[model samples]
Target: MPRSWVDGLEARARASLPAPVHEYVAHGAGAGTSRDEAAAAWRDVRFLPHVLHDVTDVGLATEVLGTRLETPVGVAPTSLQRAVHPDGELAMARATAAAGGLMVVSSNAGSTFADIAATGVAWWLQVYLPSDRTLALPLLERAVAAGARAVVLTVDTPVVGSWEPAGDRVWDVVDPAFTRVNFDEGHDTQPGAEKALDLGPHDLDWLAERTGLPVVAKGVLRADDARRCVQAGAAAVWVSNHGGRQLDRAVAPARALPAIVRELADDDAEVYVDGGLGSGTDVLAALGLGADAAFLGRLPLWALVEGEHGVGRLQDRIRAELVEAMRLAGCRRVADARDVVGSPAPV
Candidate 1:
C-alpha cells in the first residue's frame, strides 16, 4: 500500500527543513512524546464505536465567522512561508480554497495580503497587534479592502519569546531578505505599549468600532479571557499556544477547549483550536472536545515545502482521514462529531 499523504508530507518536511526548524517540527509532531510514544498514547484512547445508525451521507461542511467552508479543516496562520516554498502563501491560499478549506493568512506572511486575497477564497487576516495603531490601521484597511471576511487578533507573543527555534533560524537564514512590511521601526515602544501588547477587550472594541469587520481573539487560553473576548465584540475565540512555540509547558489547546467553549457558549462566539493536530481523528477529538473547527499549522507548510502538487494531496489525505474517523465514531457530519466525546477533565 502507498504511504498516506500526511506521512509522505511529514517525511518531506523532515527532509527539507533546516536543522533547527526540523527540530521544532519534530517536537510538535511528537507532542512531547516520542513518535512511537505519541502513537501509543493515541492508541490508549479508542473511540467508543457505535453501529446500527444510518450514516450514508456524511457531511463535512461547516462555517467560521459566517463564511461557509466545505470542510471543517482550515489552514492556520504561519509566518515566513517562502522558507517552505517559492509559491509561498499564494500557493497555500489557492490550494486550500481549491480543496474547500479556509485559509488564515498571517500578518507576518512573506507574501502580501493583497496577493493572497486575489485568490477569492474565504480567508481571514491574522494580525499581531503593534504598539502603535498607526502601523496597524493601514494593514487593517488593506485587509478589509482586499476582501478579508474577518480579522483574528493574535494576543500571544507580547514580546517574542526566547524559545522560538523557528524565529531564530529565520533570523539567521531568511530575515535579511524579508523584513516585516507591516511594522515601522520603533513601533514596539510607542505609548500604551509599556505593558505587554495584548489586544484587550478595549482594544477589540476599538478595532471593531473602527473596522466593522468580524473580530476574533486568537490565543485565548483562559475562560475569563474567553468571556472578555465576547464582551469586547469578538465573533470567535481561537484557543492556541502558537503551536507550543511560545510557552514550553503550556497545556495543549485541545485540553483547554471545553472550558473555553463553556465560558463563551452563551455568547454565541465560535471556538476554534490548533495544536498537536495531525490526523482526522485528532480533528474529530477537537470537535468532540468543543471546538467549532480545527486550524492546521505546519502540516500545510510541510505540503508547501513538498511543492504545489503536495497541497491538494495533503488536504485530500487529511479530509479522508477525518471522514473515516467520523464514520467509525458513528458520526455522519462535522456537527455530529461535536457530541462524540464527553466533557474533558482539567489538564
Candidate 2:
C-alpha cells in the first residue's frame, strides 16, 4: 500500500524541524492540560458504526461567516508558518483554496495577511488585541484591505504563556526568523498591557461598528462568554484553548462546547472549536457536540513543515478520513454530524 500522505508528511516534518520546534510540536502542552486530556479521552470513545445508508453524494460543503466552504474543516491561526516551510502561509492558503477550505491567518504569522490572502482562498484574520486601539485598528484595516473575509478576535491570551524548553535536554535551536511585514512592531505594546486589552462585548461592538467584515470572538470557553460574544454583535463564537499553548489548566474546547452552544442556542451566531483535533472523527465529534465547524492547528503546521506537496496531501487525507468516518457513522453530509454527537461529558 502507498504510504498515507499524513504518515509521510509527519515523517518529513519530524526530519526537517530544528530540535526545539520539533519538541514543541511533539509534546508542547498546547492550550492546556484539559485539552490534552480531552484529545486523549476522545481516542478512547470508539465510534458505534451503523450500516446500509445511501452514502452517495456525501456533501462536505458548509458556510462559515457567510463564506461558502467546500468542507467544514479549516486551518486555525497558528504562528510562525515559515518555521515549518519557506513558502509558509502562501502554500497553506493555496492548498486550502484548492480544496475549497478556509484558512485563518495568525496575527503573529511569519507571513503577512496580504501574502496569505493572495491565494484567493477564503481567509479570516486572527488578532491578539493590543492594549491600545491605535495598534489594533490598523491591523484590522490591513486584514480588510488584504481581502480577509472575517475577523477572529482572540480574547483569551492575556499574556504570553510560559514556554519551558521541552524536556530536560537542551540543544541549540535558534528561533526561526521572519517578519510581520504588514504590522508595526515598534508600536506593539508590552505583553502585560496587551493582555489587559478590553476584549468584552464593548470591544466587539466597537470593532463591528467600524468594519463591514464579520467579527468572530475566538477563545470562548464558557456559555456566558458565548452569549456575550453574540450579544456584542459577533457573527460567530470560536471555542479554543490557543492549542493549549496559553493556559495550563484551561478547559478543553470539546468539554466546553455543549454548554456554550446551549447558552447561545437562541443567538444567530455560529459556534466553532479548535484544540487537539487530529482526524475526521474528531471533526465529526465536534459537530456532534454542537460546533458548526472545527479548526485544525498543529496538523497543518506539520503539513507545512513537510513542504509544498504536503499541503494538498494533508488536506485530501483529512477529507477522505472524514468521508469514511461519515459513511461508517451513517451520515451523508456535514450537517448530519449533529445527529451523532452524544451528550457532553462532565468537566
Candidate 3:
C-alpha cells in the first residue's frame, strides 16, 4: 500500500526538524508511558465492518458550540507555531478557513489572535489560565473581540513540567518578535504565571457570567470533573491528557471516554476527546464511541511545517479516510459512526 498521509507527514517532519524541535513535539513528561499508550487506546478500538449498505456520500460536517465545520477533525491548540514554522497558526488558520474546518488558537500561540482570526475560519481560543485571574481575563477579552466563537479553558496545565532534552531549541528557532499578542505584558501581566493556575469551579461560572462566549473546560479526564465543569458553567468538556505532556501517567483519553459519556449522558454538555487521534478511522471510532468530534494536533503542525499545500492535503486525506471507513462500516454521517463500533481490535 502507498504510505498513508500520516506516515508521510511524520517522515517529512522528523526529517526536517532538528533534535530539539523533534523532542518538543514528540516528548512527554517523566518516563512518557502515558504518551506511548495514548495512541494504543484508539488503535485497540476497531469497527465491526457492516456490509450491503449504501454509502454513495458521507456527511462530514458537524457543529461544535454553534460553529459548523466541514468535518470534526479540528486542530487542537499547540503553542509556539512560529517555533515550528514562520507562519505558525496563521497558515493553519488560513488552511482551516479554506476548508471550512475549525482551529483552536492557544494562549501561547505565536500568532496574534487577530492574525489567526482574520483567516475567517471558525476559531476557538484555548486559554491556559495563569495563576492570577487578572492576567487571564484580558486574554479572554481579546479573544472575544478578535472573533473567537468559544473559549477553551485548558484546566490540565496548572503547573506542568517539561522533560524535553532539547526544549531550548524552540527559543533558538522562534523569532524574538514572536509573542502571544493577547497576553503581552503590556496587555496582561506576567507575574505569578509561573505558579499553578489558580482557577476553580467558581471561576468558570465567573467567566461564563463575564464572557458571553461558550466556556469549554479542556484537560478533564474524569466523569466527575466533567460534570463539575458543567455545574461550574462549562458548555462542554474536552477530554484530553494534554497529549501526555502535563502528567506522565495520566490515563488515555480514549480509555476514559465511556464513563464520561455515560455519566454526562443526560447533561447538556458535549464531550470531545483528543489524545493520539491521527487517522480517519480513529475519528470515525471516536464518533462511534460518542465523541462530538475528534481533534488533530501534531499531524496538522507537521502539515503546516511542510507548507500551505500540506495543510489542506493532510486534512483532505483524513476526510477521505473517514469516508472510506464509513463506507466499509456502513456509516454515512456522524450519527452512523456509532453504529459500526465493535469490540477492541485484536492487538
Using lDDT, give the best candidate's number. Answer: 3
Instruction: Give the candidates in order of lDDT, highest first.
Output: 3, 2, 1
lDDT of 3 at 241: 92
Candidate 3 deviation (Cα RMSD): 2.2
Clashing pairs in 3: none
lDDT of 3 at 196: 47
Report per-prediction Cα RMSD to one decimal. 3.5, 3.1, 2.2
lDDT of 2 at 298: 81
Give the local distance difference test score of model 2. Answer: 0.77
Candidate 1 C-alpha lDDT tens digits along 1-347: 13465767767687887766566444532234222232322233335556776788788998888888999989898876776677778889888879888999887677777778787778988887666565677778878888888888888777654442343564565653333455445655567533246546788877787778888898888899899889878889998877766655566676677789889777788999887677878788788877899888877888888665777777888888888888888898777876667534345
Q: What is the lDDT of residue 287 in candidate 3?
A: 88
Q: Please provide, for model 2 over 237-266, each residue's C-alpha lDDT reduced to its tens digit, 9 standing for 90 to 100.
A: 999877777777887777788788888888
Question: Once superposed on the true structure, which residue ranges of model 3 sit more than 4 Å away at CA?
Answer: 186-190, 195-197, 344-347
Clashing pairs in 1: none
Model 1 stretches astray by more than 4 angstroms: 1-5, 20-46, 164-167, 175-198, 342-346
Cα lDDT, all candidates: 0.74, 0.77, 0.81
Q: Is candidate 1 or candidate 2 better by TM-score?
A: 2
lDDT of 3 by residue, 1-347 (tens): 23366688777888887656767888888888878898888988967877887888778888888878888889899876776678878888888888778888888777788887777979988876666666677778888899988888888877866775746776776665655756756544456666445668886777777678889999998889988999989999999999888888989888888788888899889999898988888888788888998898888888877666778888878888888888888877887776677874332
Clash count, predicted structure 3: 0
